[model samples]
Target: MPTTTQLVISGQSKPGVMAQVASVLASAGVNIKAFSAPEVTGTGKLRLLVADLEGARAALRGAKIRFAEETALVLSLENKPGALNEVADLLTQARINIKCGYCTPSREGKRAIVVLTVSNTEKALSVLRDQSLDEF
Candidate 1:
């Protein structure tokens, strides 16, 4: 049940905006472990899991980039179909709602690290831990 802080950035969608944001993080020496940015209509949002949280915050502040922060659960699941479905079912049974989530292949390619922002952090952690989903 490892928890990490995710930076959320929202603004109008424009060419080079993501590049600018990336530059800011890079300049601040914040390593981006994962990210999800999607554009809809004329706006977009960027969610980033950065290694250096404080550095990322400072950089965003210095760049006048308004952002929000949220706690995210990081889980490593087997790289197979229905892996996420199983986790989702567990959370659903616990009456927890998933706000957003994304997955990326692990370095070894044998597993996937799923980052999830759920409605109930404590409950989600407890449920996952109780189910031995944290073995990874």
Candidate 2:
């Protein structure tokens, strides 16, 4: 399995917060590959997968933004019904709990790219590899 770095930014849920963060990253020439942002009450957190990790880190630090980075597994799965269910089933059987997950479809719409943060990443990776799954 392959892993990618995800940057999580924590801030208030007010308007323009995400835009500000995006602007900062863009100014540093960092491109975001995928992202998830959900708000609860007045607080929000943005999880981002970027093309340039170092640049993102530098930009965030220079801007004094509150953020953290984590390694997340990236899975490429067929874009069809039950695709996510199949992967979730495998993780459940392996006793791996998914902490966070997000996905996007490929340009041609034939495959889906899933990013997951699991309680046991190494074990999950081992299980997926052993099952011979196609990156899902």
Residues 25-120, candidate 1: write the lDDT tens digits.
Answer: 999988998999865778788899998898999999999999999999999999999999999999999999999999999999999999999999
Clashes of 1: 0
* lDDT per residue as tens, model 2, 1-136: 6988899988888988889999999999999889999657677779999899999999999999989888899999999999889889999999999999989999999999999999998898888888888454
Best by lDDT: 1
lDDT values, one for every candidate: 0.92, 0.90
TM-score of 2: 0.95
CA deviation > 4 Å runs, candidate 1: none
lDDT (Cα) of model 2: 0.90
